[model samples]
Target: MVKSFMTLAVLVLSAAGVYAQDIIQVQGTTPDLYVMHTVKKGETLYSLGRTFSLPIKDIAAENNISADKGLQLGQNIKIPLNGANFSQKADAASGGAPLYHKVEAAETLYRLSLNHNKVPLDNIRKWNNMSGDGLKKDTYVIIGYLKGGSGAVAHTPTPTPAPTPAPAPVNNTPAPAPVNNTPAPVSNNNPAPPIENNTPAPTPAPTPTPAPAETKPVASSGSSFESLYMQQTSNGKNATTEKGPGGWFKSNAAAGKYYALHNTAQRGTIIKVTNPLNGKYIYAKVLETIPQIKGNAGLIIKLSDSALEALGTNDPKFYCELSYEN
Candidate 1:
């Protein structure tokens, strides 16, 4: 009866549709809470815990695994919930504090916000007062929870102005003279011969020419294709098939071939597709909304033939747990 009750409770939690958090607990005497979460592809245990609320020590104790180790796909680990209350006021207020993080090359502020859910991108912007898009590599930003309540600052330091330079000394007196200025007599005594003055040349006659009119060529490049679009179809008075964000559209490509149409789905999503059989994973970009079609609860992803082959899938459609890459 106890086993049945426990199974029923787990089923209820699963059916409630609340996404499972990174936590797992042992069913034994004095068992501690563990950060239990399903291992997604490309996820390391250390990274998963760090991203969420679990500490490295807690994660190690819960899983009976070493924190210095890595994680395998589909592995279930325990996560303690002691400090897991994210929606609480204290958690939000204490979101930013003094924590050190090594800035990765090409990492941006927007990416950082996504990586650390509690740290608001706007707060980072206001704290740094960054004038441009985001942060660059090797730059430092506060990583831990923040202290003090939000309000006006008590005082702000003003920068000191630079001092003026002293003026250079001027000359007191003017100096000395020239050696000599000699003048010679003119030799115009042999200029008795008369000189001939040539007549001035006539101005060239004006040439007549027709004025050219400006010409504007018609545009050859087509308009931008919709990044997210929908389509429907019917056949012989009955709906047989429908697909879009899938057809071909004339594009401005230099090859003169029509562009392969895709729904764009806002922007292409970076997804990690895993093959459960061998524990292999391939990263792919889901560029269409076909998976989001009505009546399809499962994530149905379509890929180019080459991309599909690379991922080792021969089917027309496949399912995957998608994690967007910033």
Candidate 2:
């Protein structure tokens, strides 16, 4: 009777979609409250983070796998069954929230505020720790936060439309009425001199073709982005559960030694992307933030074919995790 009752209970649980986390118990005892996941052939840490609704960095830290050391197939990783707690390092204030901004080319305090809804230049300097009115190429400057609301930023530079090529002009300028300059063929053919065979005809050696140039892979800064980003955002980060970076899209528009297209990262920023299935990683420069496209949900970033090849593979698409210096 008891066996039958237990079987019935398990069936009910299964029907209710109650999946227990598979954890490795120490000596038949559960020490840490985390799940141990055996990596699958094509599963990536990015997907795992999305599955658990946790940040990729948190998952990486819990498993002792640095963001640089990508996940590998058949390897077991831990997923912390706890909430993520992130806070800003030096930009938290009591009165208002904080905004994040990346300095572009020739951006100044006045221009930044104007671009960001005219949020006052003095406020921008105070929040971002800026003393002089100078801005660098790719550095982040915290804009003043809004009060009584989440610190979500809103700014979109209008995409420049591509120039349309003009149609070739039709040369209707009347082809100068064809001049009747027909050179007549000579009818008389003088008997050509009898061709003589070369005295010594030796087969010349085949010309050797020059070898193709060897391409050196770009020096990836995967380790640097991983370590630095992790440490910088470790303490006090926004703990909201947003969609994380997933499969890398292939593109050749911004092709380079190490270039990629991201949806949200600032241009010229360095980012670390790990192909979790093979434990391979590469650091790529954000060539541009791709504008949103229809039906592109869950798409994290796009990488150049050459950059993806440097990471490991040249497949059409593959899953990867992203880490950047925020």
Best by lDDT: 2
Tell me each candidate's TM-score: 0.22, 0.27
User: Mind giving the per-residue lDDT tens digits that candidate 1 earns over 1-326?
Assistant: 99999999998777444332211111211122222356766767556555554567767776799877888887876544333523213234345222223356765543454445434444554444444334445445543332222211111111111111111222322222221222222345435444322322332332232323322211111122111111111211221222322111111222211112123333333333344333434443333344344534333344334434434445545543322222
Against the reference, the lDDT scores of all candidates come to: 0.37, 0.51
User: 1-326, model 2: which lDDT tens digit per residue?
Assistant: 99999999999777444222121221111223344556765667776665554678888877777776667877877655432321122343453333345567876554454444444444565665555456776555655332332222111211221111111233554555553333333323433433323523433443333333332333354454345444544631611122344444433222233556676676665666767667666666665555466545666777756667767776555677777645
Sum up the clashes in candidate 2: 6
What number of clashing residue pairs does each candidate have, in the order they appear?
Answer: 22, 6
